[model samples]
Target: MKKILAVLAVGMISSMAHAATVGSQSYKDNIEVGGSMWIPFGPHADSAGLPGVGVKGVALGQLSKISMRSVRKLTEQNPDYGATDGNNVTVVTPPAHGKVAMGNFNFAQLADSNAEVYYGEWTAHNDTAGATRSVYYVGKDKTANMPTSGTATYAVKGINQYSGNNQLNGTFTADFGKNTLKGSLANNALNVGVDAKINTAAASFNGSATAAGKTGTSQGHFFGNNAGSLAGFAKFDDRKLDTAFGGVKK
Candidate 1:
C-alpha cells in the first residue's frame, strides 16, 4: 500500500511538470470531421497553452470558470441543451484531418528499439462570433505520453496564429490526412523542422485552410515530462504567429 501511494505521488508530480490542463469539453459531434458546430469555452479569445502564459496556450482554468450558457441542439427540432457543463466533462477527441489529427496531439519517441507511446484528446473549441476554434491538451491527462526521437514523420493540420497578445483559438480543417509534419527528436525534446515547401499563406489557421497571414521557415519545440505528454511553443516567419501546444500521444 505504501509503495502504491509513493508511485501515485510520483506520477502526480510528473504530471504537474508537463503543463497542466484540468477541464473537459464534451462534444455531441466530432469537431475533427466538421460534424457539429463549434463550442465556446472560457473567453472568446483565449491562449493555447497554460493560463497567463506568453504562448497561445489554452486557459483551462479560466475555461473551467466560465459561466455555462444554454445552447440549442441543432439535431433536435427545438430542445434547449440547457447550460453546458463548463469545462468539466469528458472531452470528445477530434478526428483525423488528412495526415494531421484535427485535435491537439503530442508524441515522445524514445531512442530505443521499440517506440513507447501514449496520447489523449479534447473536443475542439470554437467561437462563431470570433470565427475562432481550438484543440489542445487533448485527453487533458498527463499519464498517456509517447516517445519520438530522431527523424520522425507524422501529419499536422493547418497552422496556428497568435497575435501580439495571445492565441485567438484552436482550429483545424476536415480534410483527413491533408498535411504531414516532420520532427527531429533529442533526448528530452523534439524539434519540428519547418517545411519551407509548405505554402504558409495557403495553409489555414483557426478555420479555412486558404486563409492568409501565413508565415514561413519556422520550427516547433516540444518538451516531454514524466506524465507522458509534450508541450511546446512555436513561431512563424515574419513573426506572423506564435503558439504553445500541448497534446497526448496516439
Candidate 2:
C-alpha cells in the first residue's frame, strides 16, 4: 500500500506541472501590448515661479503625449520566451498648427537568447513663432548579456535646419537583476550651424532606481561651452504601475 501511494503522488505532481505550463502559455498569448506615460512636475518650474516656461514643469498651455508599443511573438519553449519584432514610439505636442510633433520607429531582432539589436529613425517638425523647422535622426542600439551582466551602446546622427551634426552617443551597463542603470553620453554636438562649437559637451548620470513599488533617486552633471555653463539635480519617487488599452475603430 505504501508503494502504491508513492506512485499516486508522482502522478499528481506531473499533472500539476502540466496545468501550470498551460496557464502560463495562456497568459502570454493574451498579452497584446503595453507601455507607460510619465508626467513631469515641480522640477520643471520656472525661476519666476511661473510654470511651463522651461523643462521644470508640465506645460499646461500645451498638450504633449509620449507612448511606446511592442509586437511580441511567443516561443514554443515558454510563451514568454519569444521576441519583440517591432516597436513604435510617438510624441505629440499641441497647439497643433504651430506646435511640434515627433515620432520614432524601431525595429528589433533577438540575435540570441539574451541579446537584441535595434535600428530606429526619428523625425520632428515644429511650426512655432515665425520659423518653420524640422529635424531627422537615425540611430542604432545593440544590447547583450552573457555570464555576468548586460550592456548597450547607442549612436545617432541628427540633421537639422539644413545643417549636419554627426554624433550623439550613449552607453549603459547594468549588473544582473539590479534596478540601477549607469550610463553616459559624450561628444554630443547640438545646434550645429547656429551655435557651431557652443553646444559641444559631455554628460554622465549614475543612479540607482527602485521601480513600481520603491522610491529612487539619481544625480548627474553636464558641461558644455555652447549652453553657457549649467548644472542641476534630479530625483524620482512614488513609483506605481498602471495600465491602459485602446485600439483604432473601424
Predicted structure with the largest TM-score when compared to the true one: 1
Per-residue error (Å), model 2, residue 16: 30
Q: Which candidate is the best by lDDT?
A: 1
Off by over 4 Å in 1: 1-14, 17-60, 63-126, 131-150, 157-193, 196-213, 216-250
Report per-prediction Cα RMSD to one decimal.
16.4, 21.1
Model 1 TM? 0.24
Model 2 C-alpha lDDT per residue in residues 1-250, reported as the tens digit of each score: 7975564344334323321111000011111111111222222211110100011122321121111212121122223322232222222222343322221112222122221111222222333221212121111111111212332222222111111232223333333224233433323432211000111122222344322344344332211221111111112332111110011101
Lowest summed lDDT window (length 10), candidate 2: 241-250
lDDT tens per residue, model 1, 42-109: 12222222221111232222222211111111112222311212221222222243211222221111
TM-score per prediction, in order, is 0.24, 0.22
